[model samples]
Target: MGLFGNFVAGGLAGLAVDLCLFPLDTIKTRLQSEQGFFKAGGFSGIYKGIGSVLSGSIPSAAIFFIVYEGFKAYYSIYPPGSTSEAAVQAIASALGAIAACIVRVPVEVVKQRSQVSLDSTKSSLDVFRETVAKEGYHGLYRGFRITVIRDSLFSLLEFPIWEQMKTFYAVYYGLEKTAPLAGACLGGVAGAISGFLTTPIDVAKTQMMLADSDALATKMGLLQSLVRIGGQGGLPGLFRGAVPRVCWISIGGFIFLGVYDSALTYMSTVAV
Candidate 1:
């Protein structure tokens, strides 16, 4: 597929994956936000707001992928088929991640708010209603700036680190055919590291966007939340949701890379 096509394909794939497992994402967020891990049955706990989360991820993924791919292809230094420099690859990944993050901030602002029932207002439908009622359309986009910064960091670490990790695995395993497996492992590693690093920021962002209640209002605004978490939980508070996010995204990455690589290979074969 061409760059745009690849993006559309990848975005659609991400949407599907996210939709199927949105409940995991919702649970993970709530578990992180309030330690609501036991609120649901065993494995099913990860799926708290599957319905609401879907409303956000499906369209968001497609738009993000298109933006990321467009920026990458346009700004890349080396021509297609050249020996890509590691530094260049890193820069490209960062750029692409930034682009994707910028596009995605709004969706994330919506998703997290919809996921947790910290307040009586949860569910995408209700969250949308409440946001529109209170904050208007722009209210739904609250905390988008922080969301971009936070997820941009994820993009920076995830893509470049993933590239390096996969390279290491492919060389170490000496099985070109198994590179997808290697890539999946690398994706997991990158997601884990990035998720932990970004957890506090994620928490703060979520807190900011959630529907305003006296409880939440008293709880913390953006700056105050940062201070409270820092004072009490320290760095750990920020990463409260890391474990589940890492696990959730890891499996998603595995499935994503598996299909992505397989698709690429088939495309190459047909082109040849």
Candidate 2:
């Protein structure tokens, strides 16, 4: 599919998955919070920071798929001699994730803080304004570095695995067309694996994003955050929200990638 098709498909997919699975995401965030789940407002209002995600997910996902598809196209034209297809896909996915982080980090900061807020009346804009007032505009990007790292690692695993699975399915079934259900199932598996492995980094990212301005975690780097978490709660602490995260991302991946593939296929036929 073309770049514009990628953008539209990605935007639609992102919106669909995020809106549908926001509650799971909220649970994952609260589970990873330093104050623990119940203290972080628990299940009271899972949609608290949805506004932030709603505003950013489309553009961020659109940008990612555009970059991803664009890179793959470029590589197709000028093939990298020694690099394997999987390696190329991983590289492209990581780059796309890094690009997406420009929009995603700020959204995450606002969304996560809002998720843990005790006051249900606090709007997303209130969180935005409060963050800026207390920590300047930079506060919106509190976890930018770690977010980029975490997402890059995630995409590195997810995209390549998903693509490989689809390849295997095609070879096995002798099918030329993409099947949405198969894509969704494979994507879910890929996302689950990626999410499970990346839970520790995710936990650190969450802490960094939600840390108070004067908190030690705020001053700490990603490595430092990981170390602190490990020291405080051992291995389990590092993987705080593994269950919710895996569940959220796996289901989200099913929806997100399946929708993207379906939309892109429809757009391709229409363009023809």
* Top candidate by TM-score: 2
In model 2, the Cα lDDT at residue 234 comes to 100
Tens-digit per-residue lDDT, 1-272, candidate 1: 66645655566566666765676676666655543445423344344445554555544555555565565666577643234644555555555556655445556655666455444435657656766787677765676666776767777777667766666666677755446566666677777777777777777776566536444523455577778767767877767767777777777776665555555566666768
Model 2 lDDT per residue over 1-272, tens place:
57889999999999999999999999999999999999999889989999999999999999999999888887764433224777888999999999999999999999999999999899999999999999999999998899999999999999999988888787789888549889999999999999999999999999989999998888888899999999999999999989999999999999999999999888988889
Each candidate's lDDT (Cα)? 0.62, 0.92
The prediction achieving the highest lDDT against the true structure is 2
State the local distance difference test value for candidate 2: 0.92
Q: In candidate 2, how many Å is residue 68 off?
A: 0.5
Q: Model 2, which residues run further than 4 Å from truth?
A: 77-83
Query: 206 in model 1: Cα distance from truth in Å?
Result: 1.8
lDDT of 1 at 248: 74
